[model samples]
Target: MRVSREQVTANREQIVVNAAEQFRRRGFGDVTIADVMKAAGLTHGGFYGYFDSKQALEAAVCERGLAESVAAVDAVRDGEGGEGTAAEAPLRRFVDDYVSARHRDAPEEGCTVAALACDAGRSGPELQQLFVSGITGMAGSLAGLRGQGSAEPAEDGGPDFATLSTMVGAVILSRAVAAADPELSERILAAARERASAPVE
Candidate 1:
């Protein structure tokens, strides 16, 4: 029987969402189209009905993950009074939650930047573009946290690309280190939060 248009659309979205999470958890190179289709509860034969190819789907998944990451940061900022400057409370919360064992153990739901950055180097141009946009969005979110009189230059002096890269790298490395030593993980998390909340000197 032919499936309804709505069902097809829903199925496609399900595939993308599942693929995004899987890619985030297992790196883009490690996940197969069949794996994504199976996780989405659909047959592999029907994969092309949704995506032209796995590359196409990977691009879609990257976009989806990027949006989700930005949304998470947005949620945190919204809860904290929309103040543009990574202050103590929100920054602390982000560092604690992001570097915790929980985030490390759950790669599928973790931050895409930390989960996929290494693999992104091998991705196609389309996927690379998605990473670029995602990084830009993340930097924008971080830049918003600076206070009014900080006198930091926007986009550069502020928590721009380099700063954001450091933050993501720190979280990723902390998670890796945490796997062997719980105490080290806790220390890394605390140190990251302290640094994130500290004023620029």
Candidate 2:
């Protein structure tokens, strides 16, 4: 029985979703096509029919995961009517939620940017472009909420780099120290929260 085109599309989508979760949990270098296929409940042989290579699947994952991450952040911002005080602003609230232990403890369900940053730096050109474009999308979404809506960020995505850097860096460090020094992890998160929560002059 041949599968319909719609089924194939659905299967590919499922594989990308499963791959995204597994990649976040296990990192990009560790996950295999078989792992993603198994997670998707599909046979391993069917992997190639869906993706040319692991890198291809990674490109799909990057697109889906980064868009989802951006949507999550935008939801946090848009949910508050986009009209809050500095302390209650979208950027501040996003930082509070993003830097919290809840996000730090749950890599599989957390930010794709932090989850994939380690691998993107050394990826091939195609994957690198995907990361570059996707990151800019995420950063642009955050920058729009950074209280500089009227001002356009640089063409190279320099605006709000500190905000994204602090969020991603703090989460990375907190996760790194979480197993060895949990208290220090909390402090790291707190510091980021405080920094982002500071009032704009």
Candidate 3:
């Protein structure tokens, strides 16, 4: 039977969403189109109707994943109330949550920015662009947290690139290391959080 346009659109979106989750959980190279179709509850034969190839799907998934990651950060920021601006609150929460063992064990719901970066580096140019954009967006979110209490000019400065890089790196490393030694993970996570939450001066 022929599917309605709306149904096709919905199915395509569902496929992308499912693919994003799977990709985040199992890396891009590790997941096949058949796996994605299975996760989306669609037949493998129907994959072509929605995407030209796995690369196309990867691009779409990257966009969806990045969007979800941004939303998660926004939710944490929103939960903080107006006591602080969107930029700082979210980054603080992100730093805390990202480095935790909870995030390490639950790859399906973890930060897409960190989960997909390594895989994206080996993907096609289009996929790399998506990854780059996602990283830029994440950095912008973190930079928003700076100077909330200080009288310093907002435009004059923000979280340095090195600082943000260290934060993200620390989370990824802590999670990886935590798998082998729980205490080491906790120590690294604590140090990373302290650095992220430290004063601008």
TM-score of each: 0.84, 0.87, 0.83
User: Residue-wise lDDT of candidate 3 within 137-195, one digit each (tens)?
Assistant: 66555566553333222244643454456666776777677768978877877887777
Number of backbone collisions per candidate, in order?
A: 5, 0, 3
lDDT of each: 0.73, 0.79, 0.71
Worst 10 residues of 1 by lDDT: 146-155
Cα lDDT tens digits for candidate 2, 23-126: 98888889988888998999999999998889888888887888887787677667643233555666666777788898899999888888888888878888
- The residue pairs found clashing in candidate 1 are 84-144, 84-145, 85-145, 85-146, 86-145
Lowest summed lDDT across 10 adjacent residues in model 2 is found at: 148-157
Tens digits of per-residue lDDT for model 1 on 1-201? 999999999999999889988888777778898899999999999999988998898878778788877777666656643233454455445545665567767778788888888888887787898998888887776566443323243445544565466567767877777768878766776676556545555
